[model samples]
Target: MIRLHHVAQTRSFRVLWMLEELGLDFDVVPHSFFDRSLRDPAYLALSPAGRVPALEIDGRTLCESGAILQYLAETRGTLTGTPEERPDWLEWLHYAETVGSHVANLTQHHIILRDPAMRSATVMRLEAKRLEKALEGIERRMAGDWLLPSGFSAADIAVSYGALIGQRFTALDRLPKVSAWLDRLNARPAFQRAAARDGAAQIYMQAFYPPPEETPHA
Candidate 1:
């Protein structure tokens, strides 16, 4: 059986959603940032970085959600798109991390550093703007219901993972197309199934984490 080591509401969700989309039967081995479980020696062997979404598939191991998704597309012989469309497919897939970087920074400011003194106000504001700028690219590019004109692909699964979490940091009201795209993604049954299996929230506890203005309040 395909085994997925995952952390709820993270990049691992990309793998979970894609697996559901492909109708592949797999088991979810949930992990948490709260616990030291991910730092365990065996988990490190699966993902040297100690990151989640480590897949034990076909008797091999795969980490990195983007690589995992691309591998699935290759094995299933779909979602990667034709030769002409491959570049665009790859762009958005990696761009997911572009978006993820800001989210990670913001998550550090607004959530990870529980003490207000531990967070940086300037960083929170700067990262939020950077995140919004990255999202604007998606807004301009989203001329259709999905990221690729060829229709739904792993690119969507890869990129949209951030949008789901990003809306919490940078408001999507200004990013209407991306917001609508997120709605479409959320409308998918497979997305729903993966979400149902995604387990309860861990890192982010609030619906919205507005940018930090001024300096840290003492």
Candidate 2:
């Protein structure tokens, strides 16, 4: 049996959405970002770092989200894109993390840090702006319906995860193409199905997280 250890709104959502897109029959083992369940030794055996998106399949477990998506595409014979588009596909697949890194920082500062005194206002603004710049790169790169001219693939599944969450930190008004692209991605039946199984929101408590520096005085 294929089992996906996942946390809602986390990188694991990439695998969850991909499984739906691939029409694979898999079980979702839900996890929470706030809970210490992931740190349990038994869970560590599946994912050394105790992070989500630890997929158990073919008698072995997968840890990283990007690697898992690539493996699933290759094994299932789908979503990898054509040889001509391989470079772009790979570029975008990895670029997801570039955007993700910033979102992670923002999430940590805005949510995980908990104590207002522990978070840095400067870092929050810097990361938020950096995230916007990274998103703008997508705006420029996306000269077509998806990341590549070839068509939809696992690249979208990988890259779009960041864009979905990135919107919480950075406004999409400057990213018309990305806004439209996200809309298209959300409209997919498979994406819709994945959304249904995305579980409760354990990470992002709100739809938007503005930088502390930007918050107005009361």
Candidate 3:
């Protein structure tokens, strides 16, 4: 069975969600970011950066949410696009990583964190625009329900996770297709189970954020 070292409120939720989607029973070893438990030696052995959502399979350890999604897709074969659709699937997967990372960075740094004194307003504005363009790019291609030519796959999972994280910035209102797609994805029973698992971990992380500043503001 796969063992997931999950941090409650992070991208690890996506991994748990994917596993549930696959109908695979995996073990969860919850780690808390608030206590900095992720940086502990044991967890660091599995993830060099002590990040959440580390997966233990057989004996090998896997980190990074995108890689985990790909591993699951390739391993299960069920999360795959058709033969002719492979190129498109691969493209969208890359899109998720490249475009999604930018989106998450903007949302987390600017919107979620109360770092007005620390954040760069100019940079955040630029990131927001970049994210908007990326969303528009995806919207142009998302003619059908899924992101790829074929049905739902790992590519969709990866993109959906990115979309959910970044939704705080764009909202479904600005991107109707993406919103509709997320609605469809979330409606899945498996996705709901995954969400419940991820939500449990997130509730655990609420204790971590809003760190103390180096110099107290006068």
What is the lDDT, from 0 to 100, of the residue 184 in candidate 2? 97
Clashing pairs in 3: 8-201, 8-202, 9-202
True lDDT of residue 71, candidate 1 = 97
The segments of candidate 2 whose C-alpha lies over 4 angstroms from its true place after superposition are: 214-218
| Cα displacement (Å) at residue 5, model 3 | 1.2
Q: Give the TM-score of candidate 2.
A: 0.96
lDDT of 2 by residue, 93-154 (tens): 99999999998999999999999999999899999999999999999999499888878999
> Could you tell me every candidate's TM-score relative to the true structure?
0.96, 0.96, 0.85
- For every model in order, what is the number of clashing pairs? 0, 0, 3
Of the candidates shown, which would achieve the greatest lDDT relative to the real structure?
Answer: 2
- For residues 1-218, write the lDDT of model 1, one tens digit per residue: 99999999889999999999999999999999988999999899999999998999989999989999999999988888677889999999999999999998999889888898898888999999999999998999984998888799999999888888988998988888998899899999999999999999887789999886675559
**C-alpha RMSD for every candidate:** 1.9, 2.1, 5.4
Q: How do the candidates rank by lDDT, highest first? A: 2, 1, 3
lDDT of 1 at 197: 98
TM-score of model 3 (CA atoms): 0.85
